[model samples]
Target: MVVKKNPGKTFEDNLQESIKQSNEKIFFSRIKDTYIPPDLRQKVRVTKNDYDCMMFARSHLFTLELKSTKEDRFSFDESIIKQHQIDKLLEATTYENVISGFIMNFREPTNKVFFVPIKEFIDYQYIAKNQIKDHKYKAKINKSSIPIAICEEIGIEIKGFKKKVNWHYHISDFITEAINTYRSKV
Candidate 1:
């Protein structure tokens, strides 16, 4: 099924809606930043969570960081996904029945979404770094970005469908697959 594009709705919104439609037992909550006035910015410091949303499904907890990029690759630099976010996701994996990772939306030529586990992401980063360093001139590297091709290989690709009003992704299936994959590796 084709995803019905709504210019106003973000990928996160769609995903959340999809989760809502999937099941009642699955609990999903988006971690929204507290609204602070511009004048109070100097007085208060805000620390954000590593993931955008948290899900509790079938006795398992999941923390997912959502990212949408028009480009073909996602860069690991501080400008995109921060160092603290990566650290937090990695730390979350240490706990039992906790699944943490990223839900990336590639929204350019192809509107494909992928759920990449934190461990796989870290492993890919190391490989990408070495590839760039060893073959600086020969490697087809794009500013240390993880290309969509690699994401497809290492990540669980999530399918999308058009519902009544917006595009909804297969969040339930993603959760099941993520859990199974993580369990298999462990």
Candidate 2:
């Protein structure tokens, strides 16, 4: 009998390679969703994690969860964060060293990205409780709910959408704005 090792690498390895190469494409290539066999899916444990990308600038950390929708809208559900992830995020937010949040990458009308802090997400969890319908959870956040100070216009055509749409989302201040709003609370 012979034993073989799986060739796939961990997320941290892929992240380091992406940083060393100064290319997000590299990181995404490694972590991007791939087709899985039914047997494989059952054998592996999948996380209901919200974040798609996370990195550190100096001592401060930023965990960015990526999202996209066919329609020109952004929606979030309570299930996006698992119990453990929620616990970790809650603990991280309490300290001055971390900035965890989500980025909605819109691929319709035009390419756009919207940033929402984890705190805002937690708050919405409570606010959205009033939006229950037929025992199902629902919430819709509009442009007004999004702050212009923390968005960006990435002028590139994002592939793999239901329709051909330009990406034009922009967020001006990333770290500074986060520091001002989130850091103060810590």
Candidate 3:
């Protein structure tokens, strides 16, 4: 008798699970009804003409790329609009579908990194500028290159989500903030 393995989900599934375990909190932004966190969905990806994104959540799909070095930043020589990515996304786009873009830097923790959606990158250049300001390398790109202090560049965005992080948590800080956010939402 001959037998075969399930082959299961291949590799992407493992990658997504790793990301969700480490970074699901970032994707849990309050949308409407009950919380729909990153862990809630299995992301599907469609790649065409050298562009791809993971389909996840309601009206939301995410594409992720990992950059290892600072040089990788601002280094993509591609169209302002990800036409190829969009063409695939177009098929999946729906009343509840929104494309969440991400140029992930795996070298750093996802929470510390900033990912600007493809649309935002096209619609508002300023968003990329603000997001990338996380890197305080001593290089002059332009007037917007406000010389950053060493302490300022230490890092600000949360290094990871609450539920999955393995390190310490400033419980008081989170409690205060959560109360404020939940109150505001109410």
Each candidate's TM vs. the true structure? 0.83, 0.53, 0.35
Give the better candidate number (1 or 2) by lDDT. Answer: 1
Q: Is candidate 2 or candidate 3 better by TM-score?
A: 2
11-47: candidate 1 lDDT, tens digit per residue: 7788877887896578988988577899998999888
Error of 1 at 39 (Å): 6.8
Clashes of 1: 0
lDDT by residue for model 2 over 1-186, one digit each (tens)?
A: 886532122223432443544422212221344556897998877654434556565466766555555445443334433445545566666766777666555444544445566666565555444543332223342322322222332111212212232111112234446656666654
What are the Cα lDDT values of the candidates?
A: 0.80, 0.46, 0.33
**Native-referenced Cα lDDT, model 1:** 0.80
Candidate 3 C-alpha lDDT tens digits along 29-76: 212123346765456433334333343432234433322222223333
Worst 10 residues of 3 by lDDT: 146-155
lDDT: the better of candidates 2 and 3: 2
For candidate 1, the per-residue lDDT at 144 reads: 82
Error of 1 at 110 (Å): 2.5
In Å, residue 152's CA in model 2 sits off its true spot by 12
Report the Cα lDDT for residue 2, model 1. Answer: 100
**Per-residue lDDT value at 40 in model 3:** 50
